[model samples]
Target: MLLARIIKSIVIIIFSCILLKIIQYLLKKLFEFTKFDTRYEKTLCSVLSSISYYIIFVVSLILILREFNIVDVTTFGTLVTGASIVGLIAGVASQSILKDIFNGFFILFEKQIQVGDFIVINEEFRGSVEEIGIRSTSLRDWDLKRITISNGNITSIRNFSKNKMRVVSHVRVSYEEDPMKVIESLEEVCSIMNDKFDEYLLKNSEGKSISEFKVYGVTDIEKNPVGAQYTITGVVESYRYFSASKEVKLQILIVFKKNDIKIAYPTHINVLHYDNDYKNEL
Candidate 1:
């Protein structure tokens, strides 16, 4: 009888594994048929898979208990009822886990964040979201370090990948230079950069690229360095923001050098005088 029960338990475990795989496969096919957003589909499938695993585990454990005469359908409920203290302790211990699961579900259903999104959590831990699980979310930071954060602990999130990001570059020029000339030169550089990085830049509703990049001109005057600060701005896809900003700065330097537009810098002068009486004495 013991050997037979052991074999039945093994068979139950194997069957549960097979059932899980089948469910996963069906889920994949269902998502594919619905044509949902790829990220949303992935999140939903993961959460559902987790839930399925938990259900299967509980069902398999109950079956094994019954096979060994340790517990039956009626006795299981009695045991639970008799262990009120133990149940209360377990419930208290699982409060955080329950909170995490609830918050995770809310995050998924509301579409607040998604896998592959670059976000900053709590104004820190900025990274690309790698996974959104039932209890935690994983992120890959700029340094390539993987960070796992509980969903319940995530208070604020700033998602940068959802829309176009603005790229702003500041250029400083000597106060002596004409603001209009500086603007013209910067505008020319903007045009050149727009053409050079056309593929990375975002377009307007009119299907034109002109509004994508522009020179804002003389945004501020720096007294310490005695220079006029010009602002150049452009809109691009979020992923291309860093590269686009770097390229804009490089192009500004090149254009400014070519146009003899001296960048702002602190200047120091020294003067010495000799008196005629001192000269005669010498």
Candidate 2:
């Protein structure tokens, strides 16, 4: 009887495995058919996959326990009843986990953050969100270090991947250069950028690329030993921001050189008038 029961349990476990696989396959097909595109959809799919595994594991455990006569319906009911009290205490003790879960749900539903988004949390942890679970969110920082933060602990978030990002650049010119001419040159650079890198620029509300680039001329004036600073601001696609900024800066430098615009640089000089007088007296 013991041997037969063992064999039966083995068969049941195998069957459970097959069933779980089938369920997972069906779920995969369903998700594929639904056509998930956004980060939110992908995150939801990951969560659902985890939940389905848990449900299947629990069901299989229950069935296996029943086969071994470890638990009956009456005993299971009693256990569940007793567990409720324990669960209440555990819930109180794990309040942070509960908070994390609540906050995670809010993050998903409200669309505040999502996977693949470059975000900074609490003004300290900056990274691209790799995954968001019920209790914590995973991030990969600029240095490729993995960081995990509890959802409840995320006090602030700065998402850089959403929409177009404003690129603010500064170019310093020597005091001798005409600000008006520099502004014109900068505007020409912006126009050239708009035409040359049109793919990298983003469109405005009117569904046109006309406003994609802007040359806000001479926004800032700084007293530097080298020169005066002029700020140039514009908007571009967030994904290509780094490359776009690099190219823009390079182009600005080239344009300034071509136009004989001298960039500000610090100059130091030393004079020895006393030494010259002593030599003349000698």
Candidate 3:
């Protein structure tokens, strides 16, 4: 009888594994059938897949226990009572953890943020989303530091990965340089960039990347002691923001040099004075 029971438990475990595979397959089909936008769809699929797998595993564990004759009415009742008492103690001791879990579900279902998104939390920490868990969210910053914050503490979110990001380039030139000439040279540079890195420039309504360049001429003119600063702003898809910024700056440097535009640098003037009285004293 013991050998027969052991064989039954093994079969139960095998069946549970097969059921889990079926669940995964169905979930994949469901996600594909109800396709949303790219980023949202990916995030939704990830969270739901994880949650489903966890549920199936828990249910399977109970079935396997039953197959081993380990679960009975008396035992289950005692376990439930013990769990209830423990839960009550835990609830009172860690109210904030419960709040974190609640808020975490809200964040996931409402699609507030997603994995791989570049975000600023409370305008304090800027990082890319690594994982969103029931209790906390993990972020990986540019410096590669992993920051974990409880979901309940997240008051504000600035999601940069959702829409097009503005690329602001500030080019400084000597006050002696003609502002018009500088602006004109920048326009030419933009023209060249539109052709050079066309694929990374912009996206049309159909989500196809296209060449689009805009020169917001001289957004700022700061009269520093050294020189004046000119700010140029343009928009590009968020995915390409970093690469596009670097390319734009390189093009700006090359264009400035080609146009003989003088980039701002500190200059010191030394003066020598000669006087008859000073000569006599010497």
Candidate 4:
């Protein structure tokens, strides 16, 4: 009988694992069919997956215990009482874990952050959120390193994906160049960028897709390079900021080359002095 019970326990464990996979697959398909927003879908999937896993684990544990003749209908009430007492003790002992779980719920309900968001947690850990679990959140940094932080510890989060991002490019040109001419060239570059990257640029209040890019004029004058720094600013979708910034810089370079505008670079002067007294002594 003991051997038979042990075999059944092992079978139950394997079946539970298979059931979990099937549930997860079904959930993914359901979300895909519903056509929910990407962020909402990801967040719901993660939370629901966690809930399903816990439910399966608890049910499986109970079944395994029953198979061992440790728990049955007759002793179930007693088991519940014992579990309650143990739970109280564990809750007090593991307050941090409880805090994490509660904080996780708040995070989900409050919509402070969601999966796939680029965020800085506690103003320290900056990365893309990979998962928001019941007790912890995982982030994948630029280097692809996964960082798991407890929910309770996340004091602050700066979500860069929440709104349009400003793409600012600063171009330094030789002071000899005309400021107005430089501004005109930058404005031309802006117009070209607007035409080419309309989809990436943010829309205006009139529901029209406009680049809203302009030259900020000479922002600073650098003495070392003897150049005037011009600022170009535009708004683009957060996800497209990096690409938009790169394109703007490239376009600036191309336009400057075509216009024969000289980019500023440091020039070093060397002075050589001949010491007549030292030469005579030698």
Best by TM-score: 4
Give candidate 1's root-mean-square deviation (CA, Å).
5.7
Model 2 score (lDDT):
0.77
Local distance difference test, each candidate: 0.84, 0.77, 0.77, 0.86
Per-candidate TM-score against the hidden true structure: 0.74, 0.74, 0.68, 0.79
For residues 1-282, write the lDDT of model 2, one tens digit per residue: 788778887887798788878876776677776756666666776566656666776676656666666545468684575456547766786788789879888987888887788888999999988877777888999899999999899888998888778777888888788888888888877877788888787786775764466667665455566777776766778787777889889988999989989888778799756677799898
C-alpha lDDT of candidate 1 relative to the true structure: 0.84
| Count of backbone clashes, every candidate in sequence | 0, 0, 0, 0
- Cα lDDT tens digits for candidate 1, 1-282: 899999999999999999999998998899988877887787778778878888898789768877876556677674564355446766886899888989988988888888788899999889988888888899999999999999889999898876588888987888899888899999988898788789778766776763478987678874446788899898887778778888998888898889889988777888978999999999
Clashes by residue pair, model 4 = none
Candidate 2 residue pairs that clash: none
Tell me how candidate 4 scores on lDDT.
0.86
Find the candidate with the highest lDDT and give its number: 4
Using TM-score as the measure, name the better of candidate 1 and candidate 3. Answer: 1
Candidate 1 residue spans exceeding 4 A from truth: 1-22, 60-71, 76-86, 173-178, 204-206, 222-228, 262-282
Residue range with the least summed lDDT across 10 consecutive positions in model 1? 78-87
Stretches of candidate 2 above 4 Å error? 1-29, 50-73, 76-89, 204-207, 222-226, 265-282
Off by over 4 Å in 3: 1-38, 49-84, 143-145, 206-211, 266-282
Candidate 3: tens digits of C-alpha lDDT, residues 109-208 = 7888988899999899889987777778889999999999988999999988866887788877887899889989888878876777776666788966
